[model samples]
Target: MSDTTTPEQLADDAVVVDVREQDEWDAGHAPGAIHIPLGELPARLDELPEADERDPLPIICRSGNRSGKAVAWLTQQGFDAANVEGGMKQWAFAGKPVVTDSGADPQVI
Candidate 1:
């Protein structure tokens, strides 16, 4: 299978890393997804799930663009990673839960 994944393909509990900006993340994100802005991914590598745990860690952003870049960089570092196709927009549209830190109604920003 390709390294890009649509939100519906993932299990509800699938582990994911969201690489959007702080404000974007605060607006809405996949419930339970790890928040690691694209710029901070390098320093937060140790906080990621085990390299083999998820087989290929799923990375997301507001759109697929940033996560695609993240996947490329992570692949070069020998970390298995995949971009979430269509990103948060698709994830929310697919009926998956979006959550905010403040417990407000979630909507993709």
Candidate 2:
């Protein structure tokens, strides 16, 4: 099983990758998270940190399913990765910062 990290456990400098679709991302996502849909990750491997990096890549989806899969895949690829348990839904529920392209209040889509 993929390792998991809670939203509350994330550090300020952690690399957070959102694996939701473009439309979902445009709706809302964690502030400072890198937008890379799950389907695009294979081609966009360079956009992520090097496999040898000490910091783990914390990934999230609308809920946590997709990101859990991503974490499993990433770990197999030699990268330190973890799923963000509870995902964006929990982040927003925890009153964490979120942003959207529309300049409206952020909501999990």
Candidate 3:
């Protein structure tokens, strides 16, 4: 797997998955992120876009820890996944755009 990507480094093909709970997702998450909620990931894998087993994906959570496990599991399953390093907390600290309210509006810090 590749290294984690920063908001500025996110490419068109880079998929961002948010593993936080639904309430956390409603509060705020990276713009363009797809919510899968950690607990539901196994059943929801089909919801993810098709990717090469080795293509990179950056997973985010409220903090970095949960995303690390996500990354590990995905990688073991032959899907290339990277933890967001600092997750949404870092994204917020860096003042990147976050999408709330069904993405009707984006909050940019």
RMSD of each: 1.8, 1.9, 3.4
Q: Over the stretch 5-107, how does candidate 3's per-residue lDDT look in tens digits?
A: 5655565334689898877888777757888988788888888766546647788887778788887887787777778877787777776767687765543
lDDT of each: 0.87, 0.85, 0.73
lDDT of 1 at 80: 85
Model 1, CA-based lDDT: 0.87
Ranking by lDDT: 1, 2, 3
Query: Quick one: ranking by TM-score, best first?
Result: 1, 2, 3
User: Which of the two candidates, 1 or 2, achieves a greater lDDT against the reference?
Assistant: 1
Give me the runs in candidate 2 sitting further than 4 Å from their true place.
12-14, 50-54
- lDDT of each residue in 1-109, candidate 1, tens digit only: 3388789888776779999999998888887699999999999999998745646888999879999999999988888898999999999888998889999877889
Clashing pairs in 1: none
Best by TM-score: 1
**Alpha-carbon error at 26 in model 3, in Å?**
0.5
Model 1 quality (TM-score): 0.92
